[model samples]
Target: MTITPQWKDELRARITLSSVIMRTDKLTKAGREWKGCCPFHDEKTPSFYVNDQKQFYHCFGCGAHGDVISWMTEQRGLSFIDAIKELAAEAGMEVPAPDPVAAKRAEKRAELIDVTTEAQDWFVEQLRGSAGREALAYLNRRGLKPETLREFGFGYSPESKQALPTALPRFEDHMLVEAGMRIRTDDGTTYDRFRGRVMLPIQDARGRVIAFGGRILENRDGVAKYLNSPDTPLFDKGRTLYNLHRASPASRQTGRVVVVEGYMDVVALAQAGIKDAVAPLGTALTEMQLEMLWRMVEVPVLCFDGDAAGQRAAMRAISRALPMLAPMRSLSIVRLPSGMDPDDLINDRGVGAMEKLLAEPKSLLDTLWEFERDAMPLESPEAKAGLKKRLMEHVDTIGDPDIQSLYRRDLLDRFSAFAYPPRQQAKRGPWRGPAAAPKTLSNGARSTLQKSMSGGQRSDLLGAVIAGLVRHPGEISRHSEALIELARHDQSAAPAIESLIELAETLDSRIQTAISAEQGFPAPPVDNRYAFLREGTPPGEAREELAEAVSLLAHKPALEAAMAATIARFDEDPEGSFAEQARLRQQLMTVDERLKAFGRKKAGSDTARDENSVSSDS
Candidate 1:
């Protein structure tokens, strides 16, 4: 049955902030709030705070904050109705039937999916009979096991004109068209979508065959070698990865995911004992795909060809992974030997060789280092300076210092080491020099560079002003002029800072959200700099430190100029008094801490100790 908007809202309300806290024991009752480890992300400190009175929960670690419905949707991977039903069941209630119109639409969707499945089955059966022998032999030649064919739902489409239409009538044809299995011509003629090719079903996380990829069985001299399902309601080439459904669980268990270029590469890797592997479907890896990988594994090992294009793809993946960075999550790029893809490597050098290659995957820094080493003469000072500048630009992109340090160490090791002349040195060509020295990027320098690179003094001005306001709410009154000035300089950060000021002004108000809802995408350096502008500043402290920060803001002229710009930016919005909001936030945080401490004490000394052992930085 189809769920209505009202039903979704009702479901969301039932899973109220209090209900979620009740499910887990770590939550402790403070004066008015519940505090515990966030279920959405791995966090040691109790940053997932729930305001039962407000029916809201927020995770300071991941910035995942919402009502109970959002928690169910994100943490449990449930749709709105599904979340509602689950919560209702927990509360000993039953969900009412969906609206009739919604029910009809849902039924239609289900029918379409069923028809698509039937079409897939028919195609596979046809492959097993006449058209599939050539495809099966092709797979066998590639060392793919018979079981692999069944597991991946391999199939073949005949070159015959009526192979598909002969099996299913117009209903199936429409279904196939809707599922991206076939294309319709202007003349209304229907034909098999993938003729003379080996088919690979592309399934989503739920294992529904939404699309298909076909490798050409008989090659024409100038024709494209492969074809894929077009974008449709059920299939998104950008979002769907081949074999993700089968690979995700294995990837979670292993804590490492292997990403390849094609479906066969994924199959080959699986057959070779590397079960945690997925491939992009007829497209380069995308940010959405990377987010999926982040959910599945702590670290993803991307193996690509060593050719120029492959190296370029690796760089692209590196760029896209920046936003997903958090504690324990990492991206590693392994450049395979030239001219050999994963399948070739597995068939020739075997899984052991692949393991050895993976054992030494390149860090982003190393990839850049090699890229620089090949592009310019290291002996030239200008080249060194330019390379260092470019490298530091990327290094600064890393918000976490610990991760940045590891990259630095790896760079130093590569640059500083002088390879010894092995007994076999005589057989090799060319002599490379001793390794390069490690370069350190100062935290201050990084901040300065980030500010300068992303925008200009405007970003720094905004960051400094916001940092001051968050630490000292009283400073908002004392240095209102400065805040307005800062806000005026950076238009992008103006709204966010204005929201912070407004939140500070109203005790009854929550932090007004100005940042985009999609938080994990790559934001500009200034955007990241401004993330906590409204919430709070880093290195959080007690009332005394906040007061100190305020005092500093009261005197800092630069801060005053920045604050003035900030105020000007929000001139269009209704005036939001800051004192009341700041006071409310202070009270809430205090209450939250009290409740969290109480919960921790109740949980036991060991759990509290463990919480203290880990860093609170998300």
Candidate 2:
């Protein structure tokens, strides 16, 4: 369930902040508060303080601060809900479960558990009894070892329609139907839903037999081969994985999870000793399923069958998962050999071959490119145009703007590399140098540029950036929009920004040439902070640094503006605002560090470091 501000407030109110901190850290009474060495960072003396009265903790040494939820997510590395659940348990409070009807369904689901558990035991008994002889043989012929079968709790359902209803006489017919084991016809007739199949229990994260999947042992032309429990109080196939109960823990150690197309594929990988594999239950991966995968590992490997259906399934997952994509969280696809599934490959070439394939799966971008590139022949302009259109269509589905832009660039680059043949570079005419433009600016021009570069919080960066752009007039047009934004937001930098724009297009270079190199210009930054300002720097490096600097100048004002807006929202949405504020601060901090990038580059050299903080000079 979504965490609301009121719920967060209640959660914080229920738990004594100091007690939670004291569970893992040592704290001593310090007036109304408790103090200890910061758990977030190392220190000999206590700098971290916890106030149960205020329901927050703060570390003075490293600027770490947050309440109970933050402590779990930030310090302990638990996910947000995981943190809340743990705290809710400790405080004797019930956390709102992820399911919307969880509170109402909780009791019903618990009872349904017994039905599934009973069904599971009966199925196992039948598997080992006379009724399961054919199913057991099928399992054997499929190369399933006795131990593997037991490990995954493989069982069988008898062909008789009254098999389950009669076997579990204690459970009512309606209970079995509701638990997804019995089908009720409109005419009041009821029968088994999974007749004549081998049964494998579908479990929750805690290993409860919440649902079941069955594979048909008999081959009837009109019959389906595989079946899963319908959506019930205890299970939702779209939100559940076949082997998550076992795979989640294993994936922690492996730092990876392999998602295959079927439960048998998951079992096959497990039998081969690759225990961190799971599968969606007879469907394409859903958004909820992808989120579940992300919680286990940053990037899960998707291994689908080698047939056209398999590739199509992989693409369906990609399309569904694109919008949910976040930084560092996406899928890697393993395309099996033609006509081979994971089980077939492991049996044919060995686990090492499967492992090799897993070890070098195609990246999401690579998979998308290859699939579309091969979808139709790119032999004509229209065909190739469709390829480009499709690539962007996939990219446009991504939610994060930064990730979206990056995907667009990378995919388009790939498209250009693939669809268009490269040509030899045309020879250029010999270059001729013009005499350095007159080292004198007209009085009217000098006054305007000087006034524009006068002052602001970003004055130092803006002034310096404008100077760099003038020196490299050829580069100004490239970053014109951002420079215009900088001028719009920081009025003090407007005149210099306008002149730089003109210098790139309409105005003569001599005007800027004199202003930058001669006297009476915006005074040169004392440190010559940017690469563009440094003598003997590479032209490419200088241009790149100037672009980054201008971007920072354009964005710094907007970033601070957002932070202020977050602060303004604090009273209305403290939890949300605080979380948003932290994230925005992180972004601002990144920009701050980037502002000092030239300094970092100089750290490797035998010179003074670039100490360029966003200057407040006027």
Candidate 3:
């Protein structure tokens, strides 16, 4: 039966390797993996290990390594088709019926791989021969050791257009063309695709040479400095990373992977003993490559040049990664010094600098904020608003709801600090005057003041508004100045209110919302006085209500203090104090009327809006 790559991948994903291995060998749990005696070789101690997370198994005794299907084929002595059939049966999947076209395509793919492998060998021979002296010298000048060259399968493609085809005559012209080693013009003439360049083989996760990337030895007008093979049956530059096969094992050991911009950077880092470094094959990091990176490590550090292009590349990777982000799976970013790539950094500052940079790579959130924050000038309010919009837009791309909420809160908090920084307090001199005497109150005034200070209705109203602010934490920044002033004056409710404001400043918006929900502030009073405190209120409306609440809360205390002052003046200036007291009473009445009107308007409108929403849904 002909099986497409998609079907094969689905089969592999469905079958747990440990379950299959455990049929014959007893496997013990080992951290995130399982271990057993070597299945390929007779060993007294357990050396075979299986990682279900990565879906692969390796035996330390005889260097045996493969996935579920491979285990069946190699250990059970089944052919590829029989092994896949068995696994598919066990996985409860139907094997695709044989298709002549798909079988031909599969065969063609194998042929293409063979052609590319042959071309790779030819390129390697050319690199060691007399014709490749300049290329060898170039590699030597770049400080590549001989062992590194051989290990990476570094080779050279001669400048002559026919060098590759001529050297590998065993591969038909069409086969070489399909392999991406030869370019066939529309007129039917064919020439070498990669010529006069230092060749680096781009491999699959299984270490098969799927494609080649070539860097020109000499500068030439209108020529790209580096060229990579066009997409072919065996190669997809976007889906492949330069050194993943070698880096995967290294990543397993270090629990980290460093992604660079190009193959040369990967080579440089590997030479410096950082073996877990990989790079995109002449393209930006794609979603597929990010998935591959995540499979190796929870968070892969993206190391890019510190220049503008590198920053732009990092942002591109971040954009691709955002939608794919999970709870612990994300990216860290390291920016090299300006005008330096990994190789240059390693050469100039030594490996320690690169290692240190990797060790302290910035979190994806930090890199994202820094990038968007400095993407353009924020000298104007409009620019700052633009930054906030861009940040929220990026955060919106995250598919995970929890991660999205956290990112939104984080970015918005950073934006709040940037756009509305806390006001610096003015320095004060020591007090030098005697304190003012307390004022005596009439029975009516004392009764009114005592009721207002009772901390029942008034405190509940204040708490509801504070809870509303917590629910709509983004509104806190707009009222930050007012909150600080309230914190200074309202000593009775200051601590609780101040704590909420501080939390709003730092905590994720979702967390603040969760806290408000848990606080169970009583539902809007029977009169619906605090309409904004209703669940699901719009942010704009909630902010307006919060502003009114703050004003009322602050005004009551200010009015009380003014009344005391007026009563104090009664002993000295009775006529003036009487007029001032009457004006203060009228002002307090106006505030009361405004509050009542606000509550009435919100209650009516909120009810209407809810009805409309229900009607629309219906």
Candidate 4:
């Protein structure tokens, strides 16, 4: 039977690995997984774990690991076909009948693997022979030790067209071409595909050679510097990372992976004693390559050259990753020294410099913000606004809602800080309450007392919101951003809101007992119609009205500012800008009407109770 990857994936999906393992070994719950003693090794302590979501079981004791099918075959000692038959029967799935084309394709892939292995052996033999003097000198110039070259399987391809064809006579020319070792042009001409270059074998995860990357020894005009094998039944350049066969196990040991630009960079890092490094072939890092990297580490560190092209490459990777971002899954970026690749930096400075960079990398968010923030001259407001649009466009692509919201808020907050840098203020001691404050007053009340007692002005709407917040100090954190923005714009109320935030945990919820006992908190302003200040108002109704009051008092101005920014883009995107402008206008009117509904209510009997404190104190 020919089992396609799609079929295997379906079979794995239908069977929960934990349940199958549980049938043999006693497993107990371990968060979202099951844990028990490993079946492969005897132990008192449990080191095996199974996760149904990922459909796999792994053991930390003896390194026993596999999917459902692997568990059936390896642990039970069943043949591959028998394991599949058993799993299929248990999963209520039908085994696919043999496919002639698929069987032939599989056969061709196996043959191609052999051909590439033979070709690699031939190339290495040439590298150690008289034909490879120039290539050996080039490797020496690059300061590669013999051990490093042997470890990376570095080889040499001769300048002759029939080099691989003559060396691998057992394999037919058609099989050689199919394996990407030689080219057969339409004119019935056949020749070696790689020539006059230092070759690196690109292997699959199982250490089977599947492709080749060649770096030219001689710099000839109109000739490319690096060339990789084309995609064949056995190899897909976009889906393969050079050195992944070695890097995967190394990454598991180190719990990290360093992604470089090319196979040469991967070899350079490995020679520098960094074993857990891999690189994409000549193309930009694709999503499939990213998925493979993510399988090894939660956040792979992309170490790229520090030049413009490297930065662009990093951005492309980041852009591709944004939409696929899940919790704890992202990328960190390391930009090498300007005018230096890994080889250049290790040669010029030392491996220490390269290691330090890989040790600490910029976060995906920080990298994104920095890249777009400095992408172009922001000499104009419109230019600065364009930066924001680019950021949001990326944010919108993210698939996870919680992650998307966080990225959006964080980027916008960062953009706000960048576009409007905080004004410098002279250093001063920490804030203390007024000297004349009553000794028994709560610390928060005493602190807020300074602002009101300083004779600084507070608008009616602001006063009502503050009174609402005082009554419901538990809600202080819910609207922290709006409150902070209010403090930033209105210096008079800054102290009150700032104190309220600090006291959110400590302050008592009862309004009259907390602050009104000392006559320290404000009374709702005259003609104020905020529902929260009314007596006999239900707690839910009061909180809802108070939210609206704060949203109007603080967030409305921000809404207006955003709307104004949107209008600035009217020329660039008339349709989107116009639609956004209209939506914002609607929100503005909605907030205004909600506030107006409160104002329209007469100053109720509750105002008299508010008057009780201020009247006696005055």
Residue pairs whose backbone atoms clash in candidate 3: none
- Give a tens-digit lDDT track for model 4, residues 1-618: 656668788999998888888787799999999999987546799999999998888887655556887676445534456678899999899988668887788788888999999889988998999999899999999899999989888899999998776788899989988988889889999989999999989998668999998989978899999999999999998888888878876775676899999888888888888999999988888999997787566689999899999999999999899888864468999999888999999999899988889888999999999999999999999999999999999999999775687688779979999899989989654323234433344666655744443334456566666666665655676677767876776667787776666655444432232234344444332223556766666777877877667766765666667777987885565444534443354355456666656665534435665788689999
Ranking by TM-score: 2, 4, 3, 1
lDDT of 3 at 342: 92
lDDT (C-alpha, whole model) for all candidates: 0.61, 0.78, 0.75, 0.77
| lDDT of candidate 3 over 185-270, digit per residue (tens) | 89999998898999988888668888999999989999999999999988888788888879876775676889999889999999
lDDT of 2 by residue, 557-583 (tens): 666777789889876765566555555
Which candidate model has the greater lDDT, 1 or 4?
Answer: 4
Q: Over 4 Å off in model 2, which ranges?
A: 1-104, 140-147, 218-220, 252-254, 295-298, 326-329, 348-356, 396-402, 429-618
The alpha-carbon deviation from the true structure for residue 36 of candidate 3, after best TM-score superposition, in angstroms, is 7.7
Q: Model 1 segments beyond 4 Å from truth? A: 1-109, 170-174, 186-190, 392-618
Error of 2 at 511 (Å): 23
- Clash totals for all models, in order? 35, 2, 0, 0
Model 1: residue 84 alpha-carbon error in angstroms: 5.9
- Model 1: which ten-residue window has the lowest total lDDT? 574-583
lDDT of 1 by residue, 1-618 (tens): 444446545655655667665664378776788888876545688887888667688778645456665555444444455666778786566677778887786676676667667767977896788657777888788777888778888887777756666766656667767766667889997666777888777787768777778888767998668888888777778888888777866753564788988877888888888898898876777988886776555467899987888888887787677645643456788988999898888778889999898878887666777875576666666666666566666666766654565455545545544122235434533212113432333444334433533445443434444543443443444344434543564456555445555534432122222222132111222222222332453423323333333323222333334335544543232112121121223233333444354345436744654676674642
TM-score of candidate 2 against the unseen true structure: 0.65
Best by TM-score: 2
Of 1 and 2, the candidate ahead on TM-score is 2
Model 4, residue pairs in steric clash: none
